[model samples]
Target: MTELLTVDGTQSALSQRYSSALMNTFGAPKRVLVRGEGAYLWDADGNKYLDLLGGLAVNCLGHAHPFVVSAVTSQLATLGHVSNFFASAPQIALAEKLLGLFDAPGKVFFTNSGTEANEAAFKITRRTGRTKIVSTVGAFHGRSMGALAVTWKPAYRELFAPLPGDVEFVPYGDAEALAAAVDDETAAVVLEPIQGENGVVVPPAGYLQAARRITSEHGALLWIDEIQTGIGRTGTWFAFEAEGITPDLVTVAKGLGAGIPIGACIGLGAAADLLQPGNHGTTFGGNPVAAIAGLAVLTVIERDGLLAQVNAVGNHLASSIIALDHRLIAGVRGRGLLLAIELTQPVSDQVAQLALEAGFVINNPIPNALRLAPPYILSKADADSFVAALPGLLDQVEAG
Candidate 1:
């Protein structure tokens, strides 16, 4: 006979050791994940989970993809790290491939993470000699001090007082607000096509176009931060592609290296020349291994025709979830695989807990929103499984 225990539980041995050794910046992880293959993760307790969050939208190629692994291993064996003084084939090739995606000839500056990518863009904005930068509300560029300056969340910004000055915020999705905010003094207008961190809030149509017109009119560079929305996450190489406007600068990272650390600040047109020889630099920013990882990620996506797959699977996932007709669900909004399930009740956290216990990984980004940034490789069948289980989870949450 089993005894019913009232006390919840304690951390696993690995988790206990983690608490003592690692910083608590992210709090204690929900599960001590041991391994990953494809879109599934296994914890230390041998519990399997469907990874619907995709490492916060970083693992577009899924986990431990053989192509990326092979590319990184080969590059590391051949030429891993090189000072910025010397260039490598992978770095040059990756830069060229990235620039090819843009309409105009652009230059690429690689960084190790999304924050560093935004940091590079922030510095580029300063090169215009105009200190003021216009950022929209709900914007999340990164955590570094320079990137933090342009970010909108008060809680994230308050601790780091006096973040780079002369930054203004306008209401997102409001073209008129953007027009009113920009002026001759504005160096750049930073924006995210879809506000990823703010519960995957998508902007209305014509907003990006209006932004381009306003920034162009004011002579302010338009910097589009695509860290969370770019690299085929939106069924296109870049989310801004659907809008058909050329941005002065675009920063991408999350899915670029297939889980390896890599990000890039791509400057197009005249913005390409903004950064000169002495303007900026980094040690491992464009290391060959990271560059090769980026190359392999891109190559596989292209070879597999995954953009079409993303669109098909994303449409299917959204439609299937909506088809469930669950009363708790309000709707779903997003492009490609980066979607958000809007809950009628503010019980997303509870629903997420239920989802985890049911062997699914999800994120309650906001009280009423559950964000899903699953890997591009996620099949319709896999998506259907989640959709099938969702009703039961919601029922459990609603009951409680």
Candidate 2:
């Protein structure tokens, strides 16, 4: 054990050291997780916890997946990172693989994370010679300066003054509002098929189709941010796939590389060649290790047929929660492995706390929402275990 975590009474010591050494951005650490396997995690105190949040929807294949581990390690040993200055086979292959997922001819720009992917998309929008962007209410794109400007949280936006301007916010799921807000001179209309960070808030049917129509009519780009809902997290190759609408820009990350840091901003058709040479570049965007990890993840997902499994297990998890007939539960939302348990009362924080104490790792995204984006490999039994314990956790919150 390292000195930071090996001190007497691990939790308290680690907590103090963490506060002193790191900036307090995400408040105190929830738990110093030491190890993870599939859907389970072990903390520094030797407490085992069932991970239902899946690293905030990042770990689609679960923690320490053997295939991803093997691919990344093998690539590292052979040809680690030959910067963008030199082309590598794995990098080219991964890019080709991602583009093949779409029916239309497209090009991809690689990045290190979802936010950077969105940032690249933002720059692509600028190439259209338009300045205005219309996003939606309750959309969580990412936290970087450019992505945060489009994100619709006052708490996040208020602190960061004078963000990139001309960004507009309209009511989510409102076709009229979207159509009205987007007009000529609009660079892009960014949206998520389902707002994952906003407690898995899914939009109305035909929403994406309407968005496509409106943006197309106005000659504005339809940029869909699939950071949380892509990579089979929503039971499809991408959450937007079912809409049958091809977006101009699609930014994907999170589960794309399983747990590895990788993301891509894909441009289809005319939007593909907007960024010219010297327009944008990345130092560690398409490194071989991360590329292999992404390739391995995509390969495993296909070989194991986890997309079908995601739908089955996800449906079972949602249905089981509803069957519990708990008074606190308002309903369930979202599709595939990304789901939210809506509570009748604003006690999600308390319930999540209780759940953590009960050896379950859940997330309270909002006051009345518990978000669950477990791994695609999560078994029905693993989901059932959480459902079995949920009532008691809610009861503890109600008793107070």
Candidate 3:
């Protein structure tokens, strides 16, 4: 057996070594993950952890799922990387499957990551002959130059000075603010149905519908960035579906391929034919292996009734967390599996670390918001176990 890794100073040593070798873009690395299976992961020193964050909401079916493994292995053995010049079975099939999920007719452009997907959509928006874009104040599109232009955080935008011009920011969930910003000159109004990176903030009722109407009236495209909220993460296939609105451009990634990196920028209605040949291209955008992995993920989600499971288990998990009756437990907020617990103090990260030491894995996206995006296939018992351990973790954070 591998020697167990301690969660204390020894882990700090390993982290220090990592900092020496790598540029610290994301500050220090969390515990070095060694292996993962189902909803659990093992650290470099072999300490087991219940991974509630799921690689920042990437692992929908969980880690090392047999279906995902088999699909990728078989596809690789048959045909791996081919250029976009040629079409692959899985590639075309996955695109068709995605279109089938949406009521609106559209076309898809695949990419290797969420940022790339948004970049492709950004270029498509430019093709509308309108350069202006309206986005939310706390929305996170991606890290690419074009995506960063529309992404609303000034800290992220200020560092990369001179982003693409004609972008406007409005307060999220405010239909009036969105209407005030979007006009006939605007190419698209981009939104996250629920702002994931801003700590799982769900919008007000009728917010999305109002945006759709306002953008439609302005002759502007309504783009919903579903990168972190799509593909069964929020119980619905797409969160916008729950709100009863169809966007002109929809970007998706993260859980689409379970872990295999893939993203799609889908254009609906009149926005479909904006890009022609030579408008955009990518080498590894829609690799057959990645597409096969996506098919496997979608297949499992439908076959195993994971959507219903997500709703049932998610409701229970959120209710249980709220029932803890601790001062730190302000409330549980979110839909489906994408839940966040608001802490009274700014010790959410401390609570997360303490929980990790106790073999539970969670994250604090904000100082007082503990985010949880466990696998769609997560069992009720596992969720209950985490809830049971929460009081102790809160106590540890409080003591510290």
Candidate 4:
């Protein structure tokens, strides 16, 4: 047995050691998290924090929930890892379950993460024999080469020059530009039902319908990147449901396994047959453990009526934050639990840091935008507490 290091522990020393050993992608660690339960987390220093970002929208049911834990443990005990040559019941069940959420029948390709799921969709689009793909400006699909080709930001794409070419970018909400961009050679048009990475920018009404009409006219596949907006995070099973359009392909992850790594690309209608057998596969993609976790999450979401809860709490939080009328808060933009509070000044990063010090965890993706993706189980009292603390937090940021 390993001996106990120390009561207080050498967490800082260990963190520095980790910095030396690990890659410098995310910069320095932010007070290494030791443990989590429900919406609260404890750092290595043993200070508790209310986690509002929900691990970047992965922990939908919250941390260490019994259902997720039990499902994972039970599946591991029964049958852990299997090669892609063999199929598992949980994987097949997950595929069927996902397809059921859509009115149209589809096929599923499981992947280990969002980028990989998108990679699968990328290949599917290629099979259409059209190389050009029309994407939106300010879109964040994924970081890998294929997904990166469709992402619009130059900082992320410029370094990796000569990416798979023929990706066209149009203004996100302008149907005219999108319509003007799509031609017969366009394989697909990709969009996030709600642009989560760009400060939760919701498109105008009929924007997606316009996309549907345009894609239909050009025979292009309509792909929805629901990676951050799916699995009841947006008060619906999928954000595209709100748009009232049937997409040819839908990529989902983030909250699929409630923290477990799992992503899926679902192809609907004729697009379902595009990827034949032997086209793509992954060893860990559809493993029984991840599938079990997904099953548990879906079951719980259904049984507890969490979607309704997300709508109610999200509306309450958005309304409350807007009512604060603080100078920093310009507006609250987003749907359901995926909300962002826009600040008048570009001090969102400062506000986030202060909020953390004040025992609240949040995310600041853009300079003047703070994202809040709290768990679907966020209590009304917890929501109120966060709303109550926002004004003071903004004041402190401004003072600094």
Off by over 4 Å in 2: 1-9
**Cα lDDT listed for each candidate:** 0.93, 0.93, 0.91, 0.92
- The alpha-carbon deviation from the true structure for residue 299 of candidate 4, after best TM-score superposition, in angstroms, is 0.5
TM-score, prediction 1: 0.97
Global CA lDDT of candidate 2, please? 0.93
Which residue pairs collide, candidate 1? none
Error of 4 at 282 (Å): 1.2
CA RMSD of each candidate after superposition: 5.0, 1.6, 3.0, 1.5
Across 1-400, the per-residue lDDT of candidate 3 in tens digits comes to: 8758645545667789889999989888878876899999998778999989999899999999999999999999999999998999999999999999999899999999999999999998999889999888888999899999988778888988899988888999998888888888989898999998888999999999999999899888888999999998889999999888889999999999999999999998878899999999999998999999999999999999999999999999999998889978899889999999988999987888888889988999889899999999899999999999999888877887
Candidate 3, residue 229: the lDDT equals: 91
Across 324-369, the per-residue lDDT of candidate 2 in tens digits comes to 9999999999999999999999998999989999999999999999
TM-score of candidate 2 against the unseen true structure: 0.98
* Per-residue C-alpha lDDT of model 4 across residues 1-400, encoded as one tens digit per residue: 8967534555687688779999998888777887889888888888998889999988999899898899899999999889888999999999999999999988999998999999999999999999999999999999999999999899999999989999999999999999999999999999999998899999999999999999999999999999999999899999988878899999999899898999999999999999987887787997999998888899999999999999999999999999999988899999999999999999988999999988999999899999999888898899998899988999888888
| Candidate 4 positional error at 62, Å | 0.4
Model 1, residue 213: distance off in Å is: 0.4
Stretches of model 4 off by over 4 angstroms after superposition: 1-11
Question: How high is each candidate's TM-score?
Answer: 0.97, 0.98, 0.96, 0.97
